[model samples]
Target chain A: MDVDICGPSIPTILGIASEQVHASSTGWSPIYVQDNFGVMSVGFMLPSSRDAIMWRGPKKNGLISQFLKDVDWGDLDYLLIDTPPGTSDEHLSIVQYLKESGIDGAVVITTPQEVALQDVRREIDFCRKVGIRVLGIVENMSGFVCPNCKNESQIFKPSTGGAKRLAEETGLEFLGAVPLDPRIGKSADFGVSFLDEYPDSPATTAYLDIIDRIKQLVD
Target chain B: MDVDICGPSIPTILGIASEQVHASSTGWSPIYVQDNFGVMSVGFMLPSSRDAIMWRGPKKNGLISQFLKDVDWGDLDYLLIDTPPGTSDEHLSIVQYLKESGIDGAVVITTPQEVALQDVRREIDFCRKVGIRVLGIVENMSGFVCPNCKNESQIFKPSTGGAKRLAEETGLEFLGAVPLDPRIGKSADFGVSFLDEYPDSPATTAYLDIIDRIKQLVD
Candidate 1:
């Protein structure tokens, strides 16, 4: 489930942007990629791809509440919610609304850059203060492997020791580091799975490893 | 004024994260980088860089209002307001508050990716709907130059023609495309001006060109 009301890219990233939410007798049905994999995002409700949902906090919160209440995904092993980057209405609203239903934990993702690490600190603090269990932190765009030479490059140079060091300092689990593979963006653009296409890629290996860690750490 | 309440990166980006906000008899003083370049951000108010501004819409709106009203900018050529990416409370509040004083125009920044372009569409639409004049669009991270091989790579591939085509389709000005230079990020992380450090770099050239276009188009 994607609660990123302002900029919901989960559907687009998952390559299910064209899929729309439909209501059945039970409740609002989330778009299903497979029998087991279900997805929900604001993208599915947009009238057009270009159409912007120009809403403020109150209206956004209402929709989020409705999403929590109405979205029917029966007997799910886990309900992973994707969020926008910030400590704003969505974050607060989600925490408040999910206090009863419960949030297993938040998997904070950040780039291996000082600027990004700054935000991660605040995000982790937010989780701690609000009683939300932080599962771990995932360092994305850790390095770029040049397609031509395969020589690794620190695209966004970690000026301050990056997420691994940050995890050690903060006592948060450093889930894994995913290398910047151009195919990931291309796959996202094409609405295809990068893991499926590039099973042998370093990024794929990192992602799988991270998933394993997250599962072990939490559910 | 940095109205990005949640992630106030302006202070960090400007290399004044250590500075604290000081109130004068007249109003609040914005931290000056140089004689002419004055800046303000929530980063200044925080006790530490790691401290999170855990605020919702109302509180965030209150602080934003204070920033607009109390900040003693003292007559400038331009008071460029940096914002977080989205059409949320901050966006709405800024538009409403600035309706009387008036906003010169908004120069939307985006990347060369389909997913980013989708968000840009929403942001542009938000600006249009709220009667904010969009000066133009500038594409960042358009391409990356391999420092090792000097070979160019599209880190985030423009799967759907990127900002240039998006600008063309929307009939908005395409200011320029700034290539992803590691030096640029390094400068930002270190709180130094990329333009100053890499005066001769291609990214600097692109940024200067875009700045010129923005100044001519708006002010």
Candidate 2:
């Protein structure tokens, strides 16, 4: 479930912002997408796409609890919760709510730059302190491949060894790196999966490889 | 004062993270910088540059309130508080604490893209709802200039008329646009001012023009 309450971009990313969420007897029902992936976000409840969620701590925590307890999410293989950037309130709320549910582990995604890695380090520490087993680290936007020339460039220069180095430092597993593809952004804007659109892209290959690693770890 | 509690980038941006915050009888004193600017951020309290603040809402609100009330900020002409993205707890807390200070409105900074403009729209609405007057809007990363070729490219693509258009739609003043210069990022990374480094750059000129506009609005 997409729980980034403040700026829930999942519906927009999936091109289902127009889809209305229903109120079931149990709680709120999520919008079902392809592959039986049920999605619930504040975006679904917002009056308009441009509306901002000006909520305080209590309100946010309450909504998060509701999303967890109220949402009628049935049996699923995996339920990925996308959070906003930071190791803040949302993370705490999610961990607290899902404590008994056996939240498999967290897959921390980060860019290669030190500025981003600094936060990721803190995220790792947070998980450790909170007793959430970190599954692995995934370095996104690792490198950029030019469309015409196919030449690789470090737009967001991985100057500090990226996620692999971070994994090594923290003794966590390093999943893989997803190169920067222009089509990825376009795909997100168009409400389509870049993996499906550009099957042959390096990012897709990296994703598949990472998924394999995750399966091995989980299994 | 940079109010972004989770990830305070001001100290890093200004290259003053190493400076220790002083505890005074009145309150905590801010670091004095050039141009008589008194800077205070959560970054100063951090143990290391790479450290992350994994705080929830209550802690964040407490720190923000402390920054506002406890900081021994003497009389100042202007006190710019750089907040993190979104109009959530931080914004609300700041507004609540500084309600009697006669806040001189806000200068909404955004990039030249619908994706960014969408958030800016929400921000404008937030200001209106809270009764915080918006000074104007500044469109950043409007265009990119190739260092080698000197050819300007709309990397961010101001396709939707960006901030100016949004200002027009919302009946707010369109301050100006700051072009995407590689030096700007480098300056930020190096903890220096881009305006000081690239005095003649288009961005610097634009900043000057925007400042003039702001002066007209305020003075």
Candidate 3:
């Protein structure tokens, strides 16, 4: 089934189509593009094997910008830029360059905690000042559920609906929370998305809803 | 043949004795330490199969201090430190830490060029400020032997005896010159000191003379 789309639907369709293409290229048939406007990722351009280049500062920034400008994006509806850790040169270069190249918006990911949340707020402020629309916030690692009691325990204490409060305080939409799951970490470690690995998992369900919200916001 | 003696030559004696111990530990015993006092190096602690943890900045500084403080000196004489490129944190941390730890002076390494020679003067100035004795300078990569003509070419374009010029300018002893040799790089690559690999080479002879001069300084 071949379908063409534009606008906010572009990122989702491109993500699905890219994954199917990648899977099929590795001689894996029966891989189909599903979810017309739902998926989001930055794994499409990564090498299948270990030829990963490691360098310091300016070198890393140069490589990332080269990827964005030179790589064939192939008609993206909404290009999502997944960033590396830390507020460093690479992060600064990517955010500013992407804005210049004209991105629809950005989804800021943060674990629920005072430390990280504070950093996230600064990043959001920076984005706004630079004229980039931040879609919303995704508060990951919100809480962990005890298997025996089925009661939720906050792993990073001093965090409960803080994302919501911040969103409300800042006049931005609150995208809810994602529970802490060991499986999510494991899936990422194995270079597969958690949603792709365990579609019915609680975390995946949360991500699906977030995607739906994004669709509504863009439409 | 194992020989051990103590005094101002403790680092040098330790270095010499370690050659025997390192030889005994490994079946092939080509590694020997000749104390060229004041010459800074991280090569002494490197095991046969590992690359020296050469990096830039505070981390590298920390590692140098650790190597000095933690490593077993045993019944050795002189401990020479081969510093990394420049007159910054790596060099400062090394000299200062060694002085604080009650170690001897520093041997500044430079080539016969105005640019490098100028930096060497600053390094000497830094050492004087920090109260580390200035032993002298070992001019390295001074010249190259022409492959076809067999005539030495000043490949590095040495400014007509840089060591002598620096010695006069800074009023410090000018040790000697180490001619530019491809074998030095080759030996370093193979984790063998150039002197150990090519003991009879002119470069090795220069190192031996430098060692003798170092012995005189320490004694």
Candidate 4:
């Protein structure tokens, strides 16, 4: 993946894949590189490997400890981790471990809905309690476009214009919203990045924008 | 099936296949029958058709709401709800919703492991916070009998004994421990009751003990 560094594009030095990444070369390379770069430092290996614990935690502080001590992550610009939804052992484990691991920031994802917004608020509170700064909120599945009507609708409804409201009330930076797109799910279902597959799609554009915003905040 | 009430043996209702019952009875009889006389109330219908929630939170709450209001549960001596593992969204949703839904109390299930125990403690705390009485704790998968060694090995290291220690320390009730039984999971998978299939099994005895304990507490 080519990440924009300033105006010029550079090959991604590291990538964080989801739990399903273990099956693919695209996900493995980041781990392989970090493994090979052991002499540089500690704590870098965590962002790279799709560790079994990374995908499963509630008391995964042990796994995160191993991640910090075992993997050699060279100095990098940013270490972004995409997390699974819902508060469980894995989610708590990751959050607690990240604070211990010295990661200072998080980007919480939510959709535009009262229920989801409430959950995101709780997530933000969780990050605050652990002393991790929430960089921003990314609203996914913001709105669905109708093919027949050429009108937008809330697939997850009563969520119309909720992202903006959430940002204002929570005092969090409004990163961006990703419109509901069928292609994103289709590509993600196969472990492929939708941005990589459909550069022109609105969802891909939103991801790029989010990536840009993430760089600005974390970089 | 037929639950014999007046026999020497206690009649345990494993589950009421309301769908099958309703289908067979031409839908004249309510799907949920409380005791043996009155019609089944709406408190008994579990939305068995919905896809398992991938995102967890709202969907889980939705399930709890459906279980509470939509199910036609008739008069019953005890209502036992089997919950999913961990303090994740599904677990939280049930706990929080049930706290407000006029539920009498809850039984915490745990394995004999530090990790699982930690989560169980969190759940107990959550129950306390929500003002839901902790009826007791059930330790599951405590010990496994080694086939070759013919010795009991604590594979999951049974949570009940440790739970008892924690209960001693915290003043919580240690209901009892259920040993690792392959038959329990097998019976559940096959949609049968372990108590029915293996009435003399140690696990079945434990389950009966649990119900007895629960009856004592809630009654």
After superposing candidate 3 on the true structure, give the runs of residues whose Cα lies further than 4 Å from its correct spot. A1-54, A159-161, B1-219
TM-score of 4: 0.43
Compute the TM-score of each model's chain A versus the native chain A and list the values.
0.97, 0.96, 0.70, 0.68
Q: Work out the iRMS of candidate 1.
A: 1.0
**DockQ score of each predicted structure, in the order shown:** 0.79, 0.45, 0.01, 0.02
Write one digit per residue (lDDT tens) for candidate 4, span B1-219.
Answer: 111101101111223433432423223244433345333322123232111112224444554565555545545555555554333444455555565547788788876655455456656765676677888888887665543344555544433346777677557888988886655544542335678799998888988998888888888
lDDT of candidate 4 over A25-116, digit per residue (tens): 32222334244322211123233221111111222434444444444444545554444343433345555556555875878887665545
Assess candidate 2 and give its TM-score to the true structure. Answer: 0.91
lDDT of 3 by residue, B1-219 (tens): 110000011223234312222323322222333432222223333342112132324455555565555444444565555543334444556556756566466788876655355446656766676677888888987765544345554433454356777687778888888886656644442335567668888988998998899899888
TM-score of chain B of each: 0.98, 0.96, 0.68, 0.70
Model 4 interface CAPRI class:
incorrect
Interface DockQ of candidate 4: 0.02
lDDT of 2 at A185: 53
lDDT of 2 at B119: 74
Q: Model 2, A87-158: lDDT tens per residue? A: 788888899899988778899999876667777887888888788999999998776544445455555555
> Pick by lDDT: which candidate is best?
1
Best DockQ goes to which candidate?
Answer: 1
Residue lDDT tens for model 1, B1-219: 888888888787889889998999989999999999999888998888887788888898899899888889898888788888888888999999989989989999998989999999999999999999999999999898777787899999999899999999999999999999888888888899989998999988999999888878875
DockQ of candidate 1 (2 decimals): 0.79
Ranking by TM-score: 1, 2, 4, 3
Off by over 4 Å in 2: A145-153, B146-161
**Per-residue C-alpha lDDT of model 3 across residues A1-219, encoded as one tens digit per residue:** 111000012223233323522333333222234433333222233232111222334555555565566444445566555553333344566665676567677677776555345446656765675677888988886766554445555554433345777687667888868887656544432335678778998889998999999878776
